[model samples]
Target: MQAIHKRLQALTLLIAEDDESTLKWLSRVLSIYFKEVRVAKDAMQALELFKESPSDVIISDIEMPQVDGLHLLQKISQLSPNTIRVVMTAYNTPEYINIAVESNVDFYLKKPIDIDEFLVAISSSVSKGSILSEEIFLNEDYSYSYKQKLVKKGQESIKLTKKEVLLLELLLKNRKSIVSIEQIEHSVWQESVSADAIRMVVAGIRKKLYQGVIENVKGLGYRIE
Candidate 1:
């Protein structure tokens, strides 16, 4: 049971619903528990918000004017797999059921959502994994020794710093793609992360890991090999 903090608060929730009334009502209800709530009038808005900064959980309706819930689910999976996703649909079709299963959504509910069920699902999801203890690894043909906290390249052992170790674990979880600097700082330091700080730490890790251990995109973030 984590209290409502910036890191664990219902801190931010992304809700995609087209109906004005329902959206307002949901925002009101969720605001009571969460410190910040962002509402998307349609799927496109939801996707944009998600891309900007992923939410702790996503609750979206199936039907929308722009993209639709199913497409949103697919995008979320491809872009941000760590987000806990839930879909709400009035149409209970076999197709949707299959999609939900394939998408591996946290839960699916009919329209006119039951708040209690939603709360239960969310609570269980939060407790399922220890966010602090996750490991993020690269897809290289390298062997990792976690207990030893070493990575072997040929006959050499690469020693990582405390920050490097934490950063590496987070990057491994987000393998093959850019991990947002925001996520890295918040999760690792439990404080605000500055670009200068991230650069210093990343440079240190790269120097130890390999010549080109981490790839830094201009506008994006870090990706490890």
Candidate 2:
């Protein structure tokens, strides 16, 4: 629990369960470690809260009114591709597993959830949140090392500030996809930031990486090309 607590304390989580007793129990367990835990009675409510305040991890029950877990996961994937999705349900059928996999859920936990396994899954999800890959090529001269979180061109290493590193990582994670200013503020700053502040951060990153590495989609957001 101590180890799990450390790994989850900084993360925000959402749990959707139609059963009141199960919801209360899960919320209590999750609140022990997670920084913020939001609960929803059904998938629709979960989606609403998720849109209002995106969460690092989303744990949802497969069976729910209006929108089921699989449908919710699909919507979430479109809304926030980086969010970790988990499905917890009593149904342990092959069809459910196949559907969950197709929906891109990060984890599937059968009801009567094992505490240890659930903790491990959550920890793994947190680790996966990092945009690290084998390598990401920024340009002909520069490549970003996901493991090192450094940019390199030949033998020279281009230094990046902490904020710059976060910004670059976020962009690379969503490479070629538009990342909204709101998403940038939430993921990088972890709080509300002025649009001007986000622009300044982007400006600083552009200066380091070169102007065209990041493209500003006017009125939309930013993307890495």
Best prediction by lDDT: 2
Question: Model 1, stretches more than 4 Å misplaced?
Answer: 1-10, 130-201, 204-225
Tens digits of lDDT, candidate 1, 1-225: 234232345345788999999999988987776657899998888887776655667888888986888789888766656677889988788898898888768789988998767866776665664222222343354545555777767566778788887777656546566877766665567567779998898899777666577788777888765
- Candidate 2 residue-wise lDDT, 152-225, digit = tens: 98898888888888888777766778988877776688778888888888889778778888899999899997
Q: Cα miss at 208, model 2 (Å)?
A: 10
Q: Which whole-number lDDT from 0 to 100 does residue 49 have in model 1?
A: 76
What is candidate 1's TM-score against the reference? 0.62
lDDT of 2 at 116: 78
The local distance difference test score of each candidate is 0.72, 0.82
Candidate 2, residue 72: the lDDT equals: 98
Q: Candidate 2 overall Cα lDDT vs. reference?
A: 0.82
TM-score of each: 0.62, 0.68
